[model samples]
Target: MRLTRRRLCSSAIALYCLFSLYAAYHVFFGRRRQAPATVVRGLRKGAAAARDRHGQAEQPPLEMEEWNPWEGDEKNEQQQRIKNRLQILNKSTKGKTHISVQIWSKAAIGLYLWEHIFEGLLDPTDVTAQWREGKSVVGRTHYSFITGPAVLPGYFTVDVNNVVLVLNGREKAKIFYATQWLLYVQNLVQIKKLEHLAVVLLGNEYCNNEWINPYLKRNGGFVELLFLVYDSPWVNDVDVFQWPLGVATYRNFPVVEVSWSLLHDERPYLCNFLGTVYENSSRQALMDILKQDGHDKLCWVSAREQWQPQETNESLRSYQEALLRSDLTLCPAGMNTECYRIYEACSSGSVPVVEDVMTTGSCGNTSVPRPTPLRLLKAMGAPFIFIQNWEELPAVLEKEKTLILQEKIERRKILLQWYQHFKSELKMKFTNIIESSFLTTNKP
Candidate 1:
C-alpha cells in the first residue's frame, strides 16, 4: 500500500512539469510564430487598400496657397523652396502634361501684343530686334519669335506642334508675305507635321481683312484661331476675336510702370501734339486751332510736314517727354480715327482728346454697321475726350485749364487702372483660349 501511494505522487509531479514546459513555449516561441502571421495579415490588408485606390480615378492636385512678396526674405526663401519641391512633385505626378507653344512674329505691333499678352516680358531679340524666344508671363505656353518669312523655315521644326504667327496683312505687299507664311504652315499641317496654328493679324486701318479668309479655321484652313485688330465685322469672340491695337513697340514705346511722381507731379503743359501734319488732314486743322489764342504756346507742339516711319533718338525722347509732361494729348485723325498716340498717351497717364469721327474705310463707312467706328474703344468704355470736330477743342482745353491738380491725378489713376485691367483681361483670355484648344490635341 505504501509503494502504490509513492508511485501516485511521482506521477502527479511529472504531469505538473509537463504543463509548465507547455506554458513556457506558448509565452516565447508560440508568440514569436503568431507575430509573423499578424504582420502578414496587416501587409495583405494594406495591399488590398492600394489595389482599391488604383482601380478608382486619379485625384486632383492639391490647391496651392497664395504667396505674399512682402514676406521676409528667410520665410520667403523657405516658402519658395517648399513651392519648388511641390511643383517638382506635381510635374512628376502629371508626367509631361504642360503644352509647349511657339510664337512667331515679324511686325513691331507683334512686340506690342507680346508685351501685353505676355505681361510685359521681353527676351533680347536679334540685332534688328525682330526675333526672340522665351517663356511666357503666364500659363504653359512657350513663345519663340521669328523675324518674318525669311526666318520662319529656319525656326519652324517638326517637333513644333503649336504656333502663333503675328502678321501684318493690312496691305498688298505685307499680305503677300503673310500669305506665304500661312501657306508654308498649311502644307506642314496637311502632312500631319503641325498640330495647331493661330494668327494675330494687324488688319487694315479700314478693317479690310478679306485676304485672311483663306487661312481662317472656319473656312477649312489650318489656322485654328484669328486675333484681328481693328473693329472688323468678323469679330465673333469664338475663333475670330478683336485684338486691341496697343502702343507702338516699333518706335520703342516702353511698357510704362506707374510711379508716385507720374501721378502726383503737376504737368507743365496743358496739352501736347508731336506728330506729322498731312497736307489736308484734320491734324493741320488742329494745328491751326492750337495757333489761335496762343494755345500752341500753352501746349508743346512739334509738328512736321513729312511723316517719319522711324523715330530718331532725339525725336523719340522729345515725344515721350511731351507725353509725360502734358495733362492732355491731342490725337487728331490721320488716315484713321484710331492712332498709336491715343494708346501712347494712355500709357503716360495723359488724357487723349481723340477725333471720334469715322475716317473713310470699308469698316468705318456708314453703310457697313451702326457701331463700325471705335466700336472696341467705346465697348471698353474709354475715358477720353472724343469730339466730332476740332471746333470743340477750345471748350475742352478751357475745361482742362479749370481742373485742379487733384482732379488730374484722379483722372490719371482711372486711365492707368483701366489700361492695366484691359491688358490683364486680354492676357487671361488669350491664355485660356490657347490652353483649351491646344491641350486636347496636344502632340507633345
Candidate 2:
C-alpha cells in the first residue's frame, strides 16, 4: 500500500469522505431514543415538581410573595396579619387550547349578564368552544342570552366537554336563555362534523320530552343522555318517562347553577378577585381600613368597574401584597362572589369573609363551596365564617380586631395549602368535563 505522497493524500481524503458518509447515514437513520428519553425526563421532572408543590392536607401554607408577612419587621404584628389573611378561594393555571369566539352583536346584554353568571368557565382545563350565531333560530334556546348561531344541530354533538356559547341579546335574558335553548336544541340539534348523537336531558326539570321519549323508543340504544339543566326541582321530579342526562346527576354532584358556561369542566383561573360589589364593598372596605389605620398603601386595589373589558389582569403583584398585609379580607357574596375573587383571596392566603348575599339578583340554584371556589378554601376544613345575611356582619366582626385577625389567618393558611397540592387534580377534573362536552351533544 506504500504510494507516492500525492497518491497517499488522495487515499486518505477518500477514506475520510467515505467515513463521513457513513456517519451521516447513521445520523439520519439511527434510532432517536434520545428524543423520547428527553421527553420522559421532562415529564418526570414535571410530575415531581407538581408533587413537591402540592402536598398532603397538612402542607405548609403556599407562599405567593417573597417576604412572608409573619417574618417581616415587627414579627408579632406581621405574623398576626399573615394569620388573618383569608385563603378560602381557590387558584389554578389557564393552559393552552382556548379557542376564540366572535359573537353577532356588540350591544348584546348577554356579555355582562351571562358573564356574571358564566365567568371563569374558560378557566377550566377542558376543550371549550364558543359560537356566535346571530338570531338564527327563534326560541331555540330560551335564554335571550343565546342570540348566537342556532347550534346547527349536531355542532355540539360531542362527549366529555363543557360547551360555552355566548350570544348577544336584549331584555331579561336569563330566565329565557336556559329554558328556551333546552327546547330548541333538543329538536333541531344535529352533529355537523362528527357522528355522535346527542342524548339531551333536562337535569333541572324532568319534563316528559316527547322527542327523546320517541327517539329512545327507536334509537335510544345508541345515545348518551347529556344533562342541560340540573336542579332538584327539575331533576327530582323528572318524569322517568323522559330521557335524563347522565344516569342522574352524580350523587356527589353539588347541583351548582348551570348555563352555557361554568357547567363545563375547565382549568382553574390564574387570578380571581372576590370583592363585595356594594359601594365601599368588603374587599375595598377592608382595604380602606388598612390604609387608614395601618398606613398600608399596598391595599389600594381599583374598584371592579375600573377594569376595562378585554383587559388582562395585571394587579396581582400589588393586590397580593395588599392581601398579605391586611388584617382581614371580606368575601361577601354580592356582585363579586364569582371565581376570580375566590382564587385571588385563596392563593394570597387572604381570609375571605364570605357573605351570603347574592351577586346577581338571581343565580340559578347553585350549590355553595363550588369546586374551584372551594379548592383553596377547603369545605368544612377550617372556619368559613359564613354569614347568612348582611345584618349579622356587625355581631360577627364585633370581636376584638386581634381576635378577628387570628380567626381569618387560620382559615387562609389552610386553604392556600390545599389549593397548592390538589391544583393539578382539580385542573384535570375540569379539563375532562370540557373534553366530554365538546365532543358530545345534550342528546335526549
lDDT (Cα atoms) of all candidates against the true structure:
0.79, 0.36
After superposing candidate 1, which stretches have Cα over 4 Å from the reference?
1-97, 125-131, 140-150, 155-158, 364-369, 440-444
RMSD of each: 14.8, 22.0
Per-prediction TM-score, please?
Answer: 0.74, 0.34
What is residue 143's positional error in candidate 2, in angstroms? 30
Model 2 ranges with Cα > 4 A deviation:
1-192, 195-317, 335-339, 358-383, 394-400, 403-410, 420-444
Could you give candidate 1's per-residue lDDT for residues 96-129 as a string of tens digits? 4566677777666777777654654545644354
TM-score of 2: 0.34
Tens digit of per-residue lDDT, candidate 2, span 396-435 = 4444233543454455556655544444433343234434
